[model samples]
Target chain A: MNEIKIFSPATVANVACGFDVLGFCLDSVGDDMVIRKTDKKGIHITKINNFDLPYEAELNVAGVSALAMYDAIDVNFGFEIEIYKNIKPGSGIGSSAASAVGSVFGMNELLGKPFNKIQLTEFAIKGEALASKCEHADNLAPALFGGFTLVKSISPLQILEIPSPDDLYATIIHPQIEIKTSESRAILPKEVPLSDAIAQSANLGSLVHALHTSDYKLISNSLHDVIVEPYRSQLIPHFNEVKLAVLKAGALGTGISGSGPSIFSLSKGEETANKVKDAIEKVYSKTGIDFDIHVSKINVKGVKIIE
Target chain B: MNEIKIFSPATVANVACGFDVLGFCLDSVGDDMVIRKTDKKGIHITKINNFDLPYEAELNVAGVSALAMYDAIDVNFGFEIEIYKNIKPGSGIGSSAASAVGSVFGMNELLGKPFNKIQLTEFAIKGEALASKCEHADNLAPALFGGFTLVKSISPLQILEIPSPDDLYATIIHPQIEIKTSESRAILPKEVPLSDAIAQSANLGSLVHALHTSDYKLISNSLHDVIVEPYRSQLIPHFNEVKLAVLKAGALGTGISGSGPSIFSLSKGEETANKVKDAIEKVYSKTGIDFDIHVSKINVKGVKIIE
Candidate 1:
């Protein structure tokens, strides 16, 4: 019997020095997708909303992932998927991840949830690899377990769920700008100085420690992106201005969201988060760019299905 | 009355992926020095032991550090010094760090302990700076704090203590070979691929999480060092043979010790640690290289006064 279902959650990647090793799921914002079991053998996918997305199963990240899932389990079942694509296209907030994860979650449920989170993540990576042509587990982990996740190794993809800090608040602003992930990736240097890599690693260690200990100041001080941000900032409009404004408004730290055009800041409290949102709005308003701001705590719960 | 006292402890740097950001203190093995307060003014570091070390005060790492400490805190005090270098020179067990840390610690004691750990580390870096010409804090922090510590950052030199796993045994083998830190450092690549760096960071993060959760498998997997070790293995004679022996004897992981001719292996139990020690000795004996192996637990207590 074919069953249809949907799931969604927001995700963050390139998490400060973590680059491809770290990601977190945001329960507050995400996209939705429906997977229906079909007697048809081949998997079929349709983009209900975004015309920019491809409908072909091989070309579609979500459709390909559903197909991969069926192949892995050797189940004779097939799926027809409709992606709601609620997360705005090119938002830099892991819109693609939400769709892929949502698809995986839906397909797993339809198949009676035989595979585990690790299996689902592996299936999701096929989708991610298709989109990025690179193996990135950052988005996949959070989509599986929710909360904060550190992808320790990739050959076998060791994933560890990091405990979230209580006072962690994230304020994200989408500036209605577009920068393709591939383009942002192109600007990054192929090689980095050994000294810088060591420093970045140090900060990353401190950041992880701070998260476990709930030391907000340590987390704030450790939120530095030396390699990627330096090069990628040029592509985003008002990068420095937005960062400066957020910091001046009392954000603990600020940086590009994923590949950017979207910016996010970490704050200790709601007051500061609101202040950061207002400050960023002031800058973009002057530039006459449309933007949406979201202020929420670290999403401890990653993905869920609504009845 | 002027009394001079000095202390230094063995240190482990590159605490997992922390590369340069982490270190820890050893309790029993270290160096000690002392100085008599003299009525005369100005600095006069008159002596040094000639055990394969340069005797000149200005050129000697310990003497240069004492000079720096005196300049910063007690310009008016004069002292005649004696050093007992317990940690052998060229052991790849932070021998130079012991001298540097001992001088700063001794000078601080002579000057009524005006500086804290941070100040002491800063002073010790002056000595390390003379040797490496770079102010690296990994060795210095463990020499001062006496437990596992993450260097976190170097500019201001933030030191955070990481939770050491219980039942952790370390087997360190010194192959009686000299691999100068400077030469070993030079062998490393000036730049690494971004993918490599991220992989390293991921392992580092996983290692930390493993420590927190006490996941032995992940810790073993995460002990990999792609940046420094691959390049450095060439400098350490029989590196692969010794590593194979250690793992064959039940070590979780093994690697060259800090710019080394020495190697370290992590074992889960003391019984396995003994096996690792014997295994390492068998390999070194085959090469006809005189070697000393120490099977010790992670030293939680870093520095202490042995009256």
Candidate 2:
């Protein structure tokens, strides 16, 4: 009980029409972490492998998130952490979220799960803010609670765990490019046409309904982003071509994953997901951009113990 | 059967955060009509009662909708409709929708329902346009399919019938003032803050989830209209006072129903609905505006046959 090894999965936020509120977990892509109890009185990051991230407790997302949880509890001992990073920073697939959720999840497990999911999400958001420069739970909620999550409200931090369809799979392609969350957010207009807002709400509402009923066709029709995608897609090279190719390959829908550099397509089955992956790969390979593609089922369980 | 008599229920469109896309049917307020087969070649409005509406087929909402449906069919016989209107025009409670739905629903029944709900909605929208100057299926979908409905899209006409909780009830207060839908719509800003749009979408997404799970608290939390209400509420007299009184009376949520003047509050059960009605009535009594209030359960069977 004093030590734990866990795998924290990556997540896709915004989710087309569900901008700033919805996200889902990925199964095949994640980061592994090891946490052990130490008599030292606070959170300490002893090692970080494969990624050159800050080792300072205040600067590292994992360390900062673990510290948030640690400061709230009356534990006599501290925790030591070692992260084996797999999700690259600024890949637009919740890279910081994986690390933030991992540390808090591991710390809670070591402490016999004192805080609930919402509290854990709060702690994670503190660390997530260091990356995005704003507090958002879209990525953190899905990573901590698994499957699909909706940040219904931020002031109260209400997160609704939407049920992912049994056959749902995600195809994600990261082009090894960085789109800083702050810069991506800056490009959006301060105001949007009211007509577009209504359309976006309709799509998001239908998407929620589609998920509840497991209607793939409705999901396909509803995965439209009339509000954010039009502007943000400009930042990602060949975004339109890749989306068109994936849709033609039978993806239910495609959009920029989170902010950019990574694009995601949702398909009904694993086979179709792989087809979508191949389609996107073909499109991206021609662009001569270094890319990583993953086809994974919707991870129903968020962060989990590896050993 | 050559003849059919029906009751087409009134519906509350907008429903707070669901402006332009969501609505629910009401049990008590509606219009009654009798549609019969005729040997003649076209639709005829035989008699009008209680309300002074256009007798000419083309000018009437019921006739316009029925003609739309009749024209699409290859039937030899025409039809005659007798209207017994109870729902007042410009009530903002889908008064036109009730009449429009009644004719098509009765005709569909007479013709053995050759057209499905979507086709019926298509016909209904043609009629609704006469009243609102735009085609929207929010009210018509609920009035046709019963319970709650979301008009996911307009061009392809996607209607999703959301399930209503067994105990859900509605309290409506009509303040006998005219606010034309077109004019009410004109008062809204052409552009809205992007932040408000995101908040509106989040509320709508949560509302859909609340409907699926029968979570009353979530429904209460999600029934906020951030985009439309601020402007539209100004048109209704004593809106703020009535809303405060109803919420204090334990109503789940309250907002301008459809376009204005008439306000709607949703409650978990019939008892609370009646209490909400009483609360609104108390507030409106002092405002010197004549009003009518009705409390009813969610009409799950939208337009129904009485004989």
Candidate 3:
């Protein structure tokens, strides 16, 4: 195809105790993008709607990722990308990742799938680094591969796609506040107690098992974040109240989505997810913050063709 | 049902990056005990062989565990235990755990299996604390629940039984040197770098997934211990050389078994496991230190009745 229209899904990274290593894709929240081959032999960002994103190929996340993939291939043609941004930037639900994955995903499709998911994730990481100031595949991997993903290692770029339970749903509330990925990262301590580290690993390991077995109670018990959440949650207002409310409202677990400002909860079914959304809305609405709430089934497929 | 003879299998705890949380039961290395019910009141250690252990009900690991179970139950009779010690204490291979687990398991069987594995594990932990000076279930959970286990939480005593790959085998070598668990624990830093902790959790999460999916290569990649091994391996003689030798011999991974002196390697099959055993033997033979090696399949049954 000369041109492609794709729906790039948002993602939740740092998934409670799985900080920096695990993430999952979202179904209902994302960005729509159209990529077209051009006679001009270079990447270009032609238009971006609903957001004032940089049009320069070098400055844009989508462009940077597209260029990363483009430079590595022997393609004779260039591509122009138009982004219809729906997920807001700096909301911690992987807005940049959606754009970053969309560009390379569309380009790879237009180029007859020259690379695997790992390679596509590598390109996405370059673009992600521009936003987070560090390379992490947690968000990028899930966005590209779909479902839940564990980034086993970054140096070798190993990503394992974990099975997402069929009944799993995610409820997210972004409080319309900005929490820069870099600043959110900076607030974390350089060192953590060894006991806390062990506990975090135990929880993450248990969560992986729970996902495989589809045991919701184990998933609920394993969602604690003893390492990063305590520090980053301070950046978000009503974090404690929202968490307690959601848990009480039947969420299997709740935590900061990626960096902060966006809080996400996992539930066994879409009904519980919407109930969790209502709980979160109840708590955040009182603060008079212009927040956005989404109830989504765990997206099993990552980026998909819009047509 | 009034009397019971049991074989309590040994376990390897702190399996690489799963420090303080994970373990697996062994098929061949274990201890045997005969527990008999009597009309006379209170737990008793009637006879001991091959080892000098305290006979007092409260002082012995087995007796302490049996008493812990007995004190909580409204029993009309007491039990007598005869020890047939096989696994040497302080070999870093769950000798105390075998004894502790044997008592509770036998008692539970004789009492019509009233206690669940978690309750039995709790009783075993009380006895284990007598040897290690801290409560941990990494070893006891596997010994009670069988196969691979993750002790997700200690306070609430949560245990998760992980599936063992059918082809998995373990090769353990004990160098006959004493390194107390408390000493090994004391040598570790109270805090670790945030980056290392993240890497550790990633490896552990990957390991759990590997076990579920039966991906041997992923298990090999994820067996790295970035937190505790560096400090504890220093206590073991030629730790680095033995690790290299086993990895080169086609072992999936190798690490200090429980604490030090004894090292364990996991292989995909018994053939590779035997090869790993030869590699360990070759390395330890040059040091002129007396050592013992055992090759065992991953025991799906934790403790069994010796008919």
Candidate 4:
């Protein structure tokens, strides 16, 4: 196959109790990249559609990630890339990660799948670093492996694909606003209090257990953030109101998705997930911010070849 | 049946990265207590067995715990308690939790199971408070529930029974030397660095996921404790040496059991567990501390009636 098309799912990082380690994929929103073999000697971006991301190989998330992968391979390869972006940029839902993962995933497909998912994650994270300023994989790993993923340790690049419950659904409300990734990261506390850190640790442990056990109530109770959210929530308009509305509407948990401008809620069934989406949209609608809502089962297939 | 006997299994709290939230039961070592009905109206300790625990109903872990449960019930009841302690005191394994849990467990059985496991955990924690000066239930919950347990939050007393793989085994080595619980806790820093705290949160999240998914390698990597173990290891002689020996023998993970004095390692299957136990014992035996070693499957039954 000289040409291949792959779709990378959007992901929510931080994931309430998990500050930097937990993330899951969203099925509805993602970015698509189509790679075509080129007679030229190097990777290049031919076009980017419906997104303002740079098309230059060094400047684009997908192009940059593919460049990293291209350099790692012993044989030289050339490709012309076209990106059809759907996951909104700065939505806190891993838009850049989708692009980064898509590039490597699409490149791997074209190269006859030489690298495994983990190695692809490494190349994708390097691509994300070019865009997000940090070589983190919380978002990229989930987008690559599907389901719930944990970047257990970044130094050794340990990415764990956690088993998730069958009935889980993700409801996300993406407000039409932009928050720079660097600015959102700047709002987090550099030093967390000992008490809060311990509480966060316990909560993160419980949240993972809830995901494993499929206990919605435990997930609800564990979906608390006293460290980054309290301060970061100030950046999102109507954050608490939307959270309360979603909880009252029966979401198992709700939190800021990735970095902000988008809020997410988790529920057991699609019907409840739709209700959660409506509730969140209702609150955001009152603020007069144009928002798009997506309710989907957790994207269990992170980045995959599109047939 | 006016008399009843039950044995409460030993527990290992902290579980490396989970500090005050996670624990699991050990199969072999525990405390046994017998409760007999008396024609009186107050709980009393009639026989104090091989251990030096206080016999007064209000002063001892068993007696104090039994007193709390006896006060909660509306019916008039009296009991004579006999303690046959096999788990050593100050072993850093859940010796005190066994007594506290055994007391309430024995009393609850005699009372025809008035309180459920959750309530028993509360009463057992009250009993632990008589000994540990705090009401934390990390060890007590697992001892009551019979598997890996997580105390997600203490505010509303949320305790979750986490699933563990059937093949998990525990290897423990208790040096005859004793370290007071207060002394071990005293050495920990009041505040952890921000970087370490975040790393610990990720480790704990991964650890819980590993337990649920039965990923042994993730369990091994996540067993690192950046907060308490570093501080408390100073109180344990040859701590690093013992850890290296066990890891080299293929133990999945190792850490201070509850506080100090006793160290525990988790491995898959009995053969690996025995090897880890031997590896640990060989290192500690050279110190001439007269250590006791145990290898057993995870006690899936927390406390059970012996008669």
In terms of TM-score, how similar is model 1 to the real structure? 0.91
Query: Lowest lDDT 10-mer window, candidate 3 chain B?
Result: B176-185
- What overall lDDT, based on C-alpha atoms, would model 3 receive against the true structure? 0.93
lDDT of 4 by residue, A101-195 (tens): 98888878888889999899889988899878888998998999999988988888998777778889989888788787778888776777777
Interface RMSD of each: 1.1, 0.4, 0.4, 1.3
CAPRI-style class, candidate 4: medium
- How does residue B94 of candidate 2 score in lDDT? 92
Q: How much TM-score does chain B earn in each model?
A: 0.90, 0.98, 0.99, 0.97
Each candidate's DockQ: 0.68, 0.92, 0.94, 0.69
| Residues B143-247 of candidate 3: C-alpha lDDT, one tens digit per residue | 888899999988998899899999999999999888866789789999999999999999999999999999999999999999999999999999999999999
Q: What TM value does model 4 have?
A: 0.96
What shift in Å separates residue A219 of candidate 4 from its native position after superposition?
Answer: 1.9
Candidate 3 matches the true fold with a TM-score of: 0.99
lDDT (10s digit) by residue, model 1, range A1-307 = 3656555777777766667677777756877777787777767885467647888888878877777887777656568888877677678777767767778888888778888888888888888788777877787788778878888766776788888887778888888887887888889999998878877787777778888888888988888899889998899889899989988998988877778777788889888888898998888889888888888777787766664
B283-304: candidate 4 lDDT, tens digit per residue: 9878977888999789888898
Model 2 clash pairs? none
Tell me the alpha-carbon RMSD of every candidate: 2.9, 0.9, 1.1, 1.8
Docking class of 3: high
lDDT of 1 at A194: 86
What are the per-residue Cα lDDT tens digits for candidate 2 across A1-307?
8899999999999999999999999999999999999999898999899778999989999888888998899979999999999999989989899999999999999998889999999999999988888899899999999999999988889999999999999999999877766778899999999999999999999999999999999999999999899999999999999999999999999998999879999999999999999899899999988999999999999999998
Indicate whether candidate 2 or candidate 3 has the larger DockQ: 3
Q: Evaluate candidate 1 by giving its C-alpha RMSD to the native, one decimal.
A: 2.9
